[model samples]
Structure formats: C-alpha cells, structure tokens
Target: MRLPPLKALPVFEAVARTLSFSAAAEELHVTQSAVSHQIRQLEDDLGESLFERGGRRVALTEQGERYLEAIAPALAQIERASEQLRGVTDSRIRLAVPSSFAVSWLIPRLPHLQRQHPELDLDLEMLADMPLMSERLADCFITFRYRQRGYSSERLYVERLFAVCSRQYWNRVRDELDEAGLRKRGSGVTIRPEWLTRFTLLSAASVFERPGEDWRRWFAAGEAKLPADAHVQHFSHMLLAHEAARHHQGIALSNDYMLDTASDPDLIKLPTHELQTGDEFHFACKTARRNEPGIRHLSQWLVKQAEASGWKV
Candidate 1:
C-alpha cells in the first residue's frame, strides 16, 4: 500500500503534538490554512480522519494516536541517522590553530560541539603561524594576530597576560608572607622572608616577543626587578611554557584564556593586577568555503559555544 507524502509528516506531527492547528501553525511559522491542508491530505492518504474537531480545539483520533506513536520514533531516528551520515559523507573540516589556543580555549570547549552534534567529525591541527585567508593547508585557522588584514580576518577574542604560579608555590609560603612583606618584592607575589631570600624569580624566553608586553612591564609598574640568578626557560609554544608554570617549575606571564583553558588546577593567579596586550586572537577561513554547510554550521556553533563557556578567545 502506498503511504502519505513524507514531507507532510512534520506539519502533521507538530499539529498532533500541540493538539491545535493554530499552535502548530505558529510553531511552523505557516498559515493555519496550510496546516489544515496538509493534515487533510494526510488523512486522505491514510483513508481516515486523524483529528476530531471539537469547536476550536483538535484532538487526535485513536488511529492518529497510533500513527504518532509509530511515526515519531521513526522520524527522530531518521533525523539522527541523517546527521551521522552527514558527519561521515559530508566535507570534513581541518582546523589549524596555535598551540596555546588549541590547548587553553578551543580544546576545552570542543566537547560541547561533539556532544551536541555527535555526527560531526572534526580534525584539529596545531601551528604557530598567523591565521590568514590565503593559507594553503587549512580549511580554517585560529591564531593570535595583531590586526585584520582582509575580509576573512575577523577578531574572535583579544586577551592579555597575568602573572600566574603553581598552587604549590602559593601554599608553600602563604603564612610567612603578609601582604606588606610581599609588596616589598615589588611585582612578585608576597612570600615569607625566608622564602624570598631563596626562591628564584621565573623568566620567559627573550624570543617570545609581544610588543610593549612582558613580565618586565609588570615589574616596572610595581618598581620591582627580577631576582639575580633566577632560572630562565625557553619554549617554542606558549602552551608548553604555561605547562611548565603549572608544574611548579616557575611562575609565568599568561593570558586569561590560557589560565581558564588549563586542565591542571595546580596553576593559580598571583593577584588581579595584570599586564595588557593589545594583540588579538582571530578566526580566518577561505572566503569561498566560509558559507559551505558544514563549515558554516561549525563556525556558528563554535562561536556560540565558546561565548557561552566564558572563554572570549
């Protein structure tokens, strides 16, 4: 036996669930007459009345209830199956991101998208190059850049660095260093007199350059100087540097997104006072592929998820 046209199922489902053609019309954003027409067509296809009209209200008949019970689960399953197939068959997106952002911002927020759309497959790649529209290897790229160079370069987030140290570092000398004693060290966090004499200051690699931004600026503001013979470490990626700090190796200058993104609870900020960097993290994709269905969906969903999760970068 031939079944009803598949397209009218949504119109019929909405009306049946709501028990009112007007309500379904409002939800579907269609005219009441349009909803009535589809339901009538569906009834004719099934050779029965699906709804009993009682004045303005509509109630499903026995057959209508059975049809809903049978069709609802099938329709829902079809929708999910379609997405799964889309995830596999549709275009796959390749993302190249800076190591810092991949770890501290985008990586943490990825689960939201995966949970919301399980069928969507994502491939993430990390790099340090500035994101640009003309990149050859990436469908999309996220990187920290100074300014927008073209239409595809849109600012996703702007962040600045703060002084952060390990939890061990904080607890080790919390009792000995009162607020005043700590202030004497100038920019550093307060430490006990004994701890101050021994604990060395941490410094970043000289090559890790951000214009007008560094621990030095922070030190100058507080009239402090790095302790002599303090240990210095070099890392090619900011994430690696931050990880070192999290391990209690040393304190480091870091950004809010970096701090928020770290999985290790060992790292903590020294205080609210922070150094500001005008540099911004940007999102860039090829102009042609920007509107493609998979990329578009991911772009919109990612932005919303990131904003809701509180990591602006």
Candidate 2:
C-alpha cells in the first residue's frame, strides 16, 4: 500500500490529538491557516472529512479516529527507527548553554561524557545570554544567575572573580616597572595594586556590568583602587576578553570556572584579589523533562564533575 503524503500525517496527528487547529499549529510551529490547508489537502486525498467542526472547537470524526489509531503507531515506529539509525535512543538532549561556558567548561568534558555514554547524543545551542524559560528553545539550559519559577534547576558552580594576564605580559610589565624605578623585593618582584592601571584593562562589558559584578566591585574586593582615568578595552563577552588576555592584549578580569590555573601555564592569576559575586552557574530545564533518561544522565554527570572539581553544588 502506498502512503498519502507523509507530511500531512504529522499535521493530521497533531490536530487529531489536540482537537484544535490553533493548538496543533502552535505545537507544529506553523500558522492555524497552514494546519487547515494541510488538513484540507489530506481530506481531499482521502475523500473523507476527518473532523467535525463546531462553533469554536473541533472533534475527530469516526473516520478520523480510526485513521489516527492506525497512523500514530506507524509514525512512532518511524521515529524510533530513525533514532536508532542515528545511533541514539528516544533520549536525545537539546541543551542551550552560554557560549563562554560551552567553550571553557562543557566542551572540555564532552569527550569523557561521549566515552561513557556513547549511545547518547547531545545537541548544544550556544547563546550569548540566557534565554527565557518560557521560550522552550532547548530541552535544558546551562547558564549563570538563571532562575525561573516553573522549571527545575540545579547549581553547578559558584563563580569567583579574579584578574588574569598572560605570563609574557606579566613578565614584560614587571621588567618595565622595575626599570622605571619600581622596587624589587629580594629575588621576587612585587607588583603594586596601583600598577594594574598601567596596563590596558580588558573588561567583560556585559557580564561584569550586571549590577554587582563590575571592575569597581573587584577592585574593592581586592583592596585595590582604580585610578580616576584608567585605559580599558571593553568586549561584550567574557570569552572575547579571555582571548584578549591570552594574546597579551591586556589584563582580563576572569572567573575561576573558566580559567584552569593548574594546567594553563601561559595564563597567570594576579595576586591579592578574589570576588565572590553570590551568583552561580546552574543547569535548568522544564520540570516535565527532568525525568527523561538523557536529561537525568547529563544532569548527574554535570553535578559529579562540579563536585570533583570542588565547586559548590
């Protein structure tokens, strides 16, 4: 037996299951008129009225009910088969993450996760900012300072802010300042708090300017005062600032979560300052999706990694 246009089946199923053209359209991300058009086309092809339309609502007709029963299982089987062929189960996770977090944290750990759960597939959407929970853009979101009422959330890490510079930049500054009449203590050279103003400050314009997470706050926390007029280069994102610091363009205020102090020999954290912003990283998703196998597994893995790294949960 040949199939009537396969595209219309999903439209029909959505409309039949919901019994509302508008609801089906919303679920299918189309207009109600488009749903009606597809249904009309399907009905013409089958030579039957699939729905009984009332004043405002709709109900599946007897033929429609039978058609739904027959096709729903077939569609489900096709979906399952497609997933299987793609080497995944019904548990694929669509995760939305901040671009900086994805690059600094999640991407590094992805290889280990893939090794552990080869059957799972993760689709990552990187956004500059956290999306509203109501948008439902992805199955889960990993972000900083995100809180929503209807969704379930788990803390991943608390952020500690500090200044970071390339080792080459630090050495160049130290030598320059020492030659320029700055005192050197014994074998080790000391950089004064005010000396930070000498270098071009790379600021995360968006991230730090969010209320309490600013250069002023960091300076206060470190007991260092900024000069009235300090030369600063601003970037909209922390990732960009980090890159600038890495390339020796300037010193960047960095969060502990992104900087690997032990392994990264090129970047060095400047002494005498750390700011605890009370804000934390979190993994969140709709409560309904909390129990899905892929979500559960990924959430657990994230929590484990956080704990292993000694980050606050």
Candidate 3:
C-alpha cells in the first residue's frame, strides 16, 4: 500500500488537531503559507477537500475527520517505535524549574547532561511560580514546595540561608570600622550581626514572609537580634536581590541553591550563622510516569549532580 506523502501527515495532523493553520505552523516551526501549501498538496493527492474554510477559520470535513481518526493512532505508533529504537522512550522532556534555580544551578550543568544524552532533548520552562503538575504543562517539575499533591517525587537538596555582600562593600565597611577603631574584637577583626544594620538590608519579601524563611528567624537562629530600625530594601525575587547584593547595593540573605559561587567571584559570604529553611528541593512527576526511561535518566543525573554538591539525597 502507498502512503499519502509521509511529510504531509504531520502537517495535516497538527492543523486538524488545532483547527488553525497559524497554530499548526507555530507548532511545526513553519510559516502559515507552508502549512496551507502542504494541506493543498495532500488534498489534491487524495482527490477530496480536507477542510471547510470560512473567513479566517477552518474545520475538518467528514472525510478529514475520518482520515484523522485513522492516521492519529498510526502516527503515534510510529513515534513510539522511533523513540524505542533510539533508546529514549521520550524524545523530549519538558521541565518546569524555578527561575532562580534555572539561572544559578541547572543551566550551568545542562551542557554535561546534553553531551551525555545527545538523543534526548530538554525543553526548560523557567517559571516564577510553581508549575501545574500535569502532563499538559510539563513532563517534570523541580520545585522547593513541599506539597506534591500525590505526585511521585525525590528529594534533591536542602537549602541553607546565609548573608552575602559584595567584596567592595565589605571593604568599605571594614575601612570605616577601622577608622573608628571598632574593627577588632577579642583577637581578630570581627563584625557583629548588629553591624549588618548599618548597611541597607536587601531581602526577598516573599521569602521573608514565608514561615521559617525570614530575617527574624535567621537572626534568631544565629543567637542575634534583628535591629528594630534596620535599613532595608525589599525585592520580590531572590535573583534580583542577589544581583542587588552583587552590585554592592546592600547585604542580601542567600540560600545554597540560589548562589553560583564560581560565577560571581566578587560576592563575599558574610561569616554569619546559617539557618535551614526546612524546605527540600524535589523533582516531581506523575506517579505512573516516574519509571519512563527519559524521566528515570534525568532524575538519576540530577541526583548525581546534587550529591556532588554535598547534598545527601
């Protein structure tokens, strides 16, 4: 049996499913005219009209609907076979990761993973908020949220917060303290936690508002009290706060996962106490899809990377 041009099947399928040539073109990474030309070719080859066009909208005719029903399952089978042959059951893994983590953590390490699994593709969606845990939105999600809503998940790492500032800012503060003859205490130069009040305190407002992830909790954990009139600047996102601190704007509280030590050499970590926020990073997916070859490979790779960074699990 002869096949209706193999190339046209996908174009036809996409248009039929979306009912819009523009949408189909976008999904196929082609122009709208390209989709129209392919559809025309297919219709001419089949000697029947596949779509009923009115104004700017189009719909499948009876023949087109019947054809779709017949071809969709066959196309799926072909895709599955191709994936199986390639030893990657999922050709692409759509991952939803937090923006900060994506920028500071995952991206730096992506090259290694891509090199190892050239046949596998990763589609990353950097989201500010938690992603909807469904196949429609993403194949997997890496998040700090504890609530998984019954999804299968593996703990990746636990984040500990500490104070950080630009080296330039630290030098200026040290010089001022030295000029005032207040830099040394006991046997060495020391800056008290209260000294932080002297500088503008840059903070992520949302993180501070979270139960155990606040400046008050961090200060308390360090056996210090936050000054009542601490100079402060608030940011909604930690990435911005970190950047602010990097630029010598102020001191910012940073967590382990959000700071790339190698990338920002000028950022100096303040020798202050650390506080565990009780939040664990995790990779989550639908329970049934956990064992898929692509998901399993990615999960194992991520775990290995996390373990290399001193995370226990």
Per-prediction TM-score: 0.57, 0.68, 0.67
The residue-by-residue lDDT of candidate 1 on 253-303, one tens digit each, is 787677764455778876645555657666666554568677777778867
| Candidate 2, pairs of clashing residues | none
Distance (Å) between predicted and true CA of 247, model 1? 2.2
- Alpha carbon lDDT of each predicted model: 0.65, 0.78, 0.79
TM-score of model number 3: 0.67
On the 0 to 100 scale, the lDDT of residue 259 in model 3 is 69
Residue pairs whose backbone atoms clash in candidate 1: 182-190
Return the number of clashes found in candidate 1. Answer: 1
Top lDDT: which candidate number? 3
Off by over 4 Å in 2: 1-88, 177-183, 186-192, 210-213
> Ranking under TM-score, best-scoring first?
2, 3, 1
On lDDT, who's better, 1 or 3? 3
lDDT of 1 at 122: 82
